[model samples]
Target: MILYIKYMVSLRCKILVKDELIKLGLHYVIVDLGTVEILENITQQQHDELKKSLLKSGLELLDDKKSILIEKIKAVIIEMVHYAEELPVTNYSNYISDKLGYDYTYLSNTFSEVKGVNIQQFIILHKIEKVKELLLYDDLNLTEIAYKLHYSSVSHLSNQFKKITGLSPSYFKKIKMKRSGNLENT
Candidate 1:
């Protein structure tokens, strides 16, 4: 039995789903983001119980094909941005199409219709979020972070970061430091 789950975006979400399956005494074959495969077929009652359990943990089982595809797209993008060591050499549209085995036009249209943003914008948003995460770590310099995120240059990274965050990277880092210091004092 295969289950398509919504909002299963992080490692913690995967762990929670795995724990739930174990609690239900269900053996799973795979538990990737947004999808799970069980070793045995489950009864309707078990499915219902599993659904209820997932819901309690803030996850949802997707039944519709379109919704499932959308979740899959999100899962792939999240994995690429947050987990992958290197970005694809090709353009994201080509990469996404090849990865999903769907035409770029169809994927773009579907994602835009469902997400209210174009796929490129979605990728940029995720990239920016990743940049923020790297900034927070403070392990890399801006130039290094820009290269790590595949930005053309530090200026380009700073420009986009400022456009999205309303503050330069340095300023953002300073603000975060201030907050941490204040928290320590409190």
Candidate 2:
């Protein structure tokens, strides 16, 4: 059985889900991002138990198709922005559309409807979060960060970062204070 889960966006989340499955004596073939493939069919009892366990850890199993699709879209975006070592050469819309096998308009509309924000808004939000992470690390300059995040130019990145975060990239890096919406919230 394949189970789609919400808020399973990080390596630590994957590990936690794997541990929970093992503790429940369930065998899973794979656990990735938002979905898990299990070796054995699950019983209602196991499902309920797993749900309760996952809930305690702030994760939920998705039963509805629409909700699952939304999570899949979010997962794909999150993976591309955060986990991938480098950005793709193609435009994000094309890359995401090809990856998810859905039209860009449909995916964007669905994502916006479910997430209460447009896809571009979500991408900007996430990119800003990435900039915060990079800035805090103090390992990259504005230009490098801009290039790493695939911004057209440092000025463009700074403008967007300031618009979303209310602080310029340079000021943000210098302050090193807690900005809202980091990895924990996202």
Candidate 3:
């Protein structure tokens, strides 16, 4: 049996889902972001209990097909942007469509209607957020970060980063350092 979970985005969320499943005495084959596969079919009592338990922790057991797809889209994007070792070599549309096994136009239309932003904009937003994280880490130069996230060039990355954050990457990193310095003195 496969179950979809809403708001299950992080590693911590995965752990919590696993813990809940164990407590319910349910055996699961997989507990990934936004989805789980179980060996045994869940009884209504067990399902209700699991749903209530997850809700207490700010998660939800989802049943709506469209909502499930939307959450799947979010999970894929989060995994790609934050957890994956490298971004996809292909374009975002193809990557997403291939991952979900759906037509890109349908997925794009649904996402735009529900999220009020086009898929490309959504990808750019996530990419910019990743750039901010890399900048804060100080492990990679701007050029390296650009390449890692598959940006055309450092200039393109900088422009998008500035447009989203209203600050240059250097200025953002400087702010973090300045804040850390002030905290150390206090």
Instruction: Report clashes for each candidate as comma-separated counts.
Output: 0, 0, 0
For candidate 2, write residues 1-186 as lDDT tens digits.
Answer: 899888657778998899899999999998988899999999999999989999999999888888998888888888888889997789989998999899999999898888899878888888899889988865888899999989999999989998998988878876665454354467
Model 3: how far residue 69 lies from native, Å:
0.3
Best by lDDT: 3
Instruction: Give RMSD (Å) of candidate 2 vs. truth.
Output: 4.9
- Model 1 lDDT, full chain set: 0.89
Clash pairs of candidate 1?
Answer: none
lDDT (Cα, tens digit) per residue for candidate 3, span 21-42: 9999999999888899999999
In candidate 2 the C-alpha lDDT for residue 167 amounts to: 88
Error of 1 at 121 (Å): 1.0
Ranking of candidates on lDDT, top first:
3, 1, 2
Q: Top model by TM-score, which number?
A: 3
Please give the range of 10 consecutive residues that has the lowest summed lDDT in model 2.
175-184
- Compared with the true structure, what per-residue lDDT tens digits does model 1 show for residues 1-186? 889988656779999999999998999999998889999998888889989999999999888888998888888888888899998878888988999999999999998999899888888889989988988975998999998888999999999989988999999989998999999999
TM accuracy, model 3: 0.95
Off by over 4 Å in 1: none
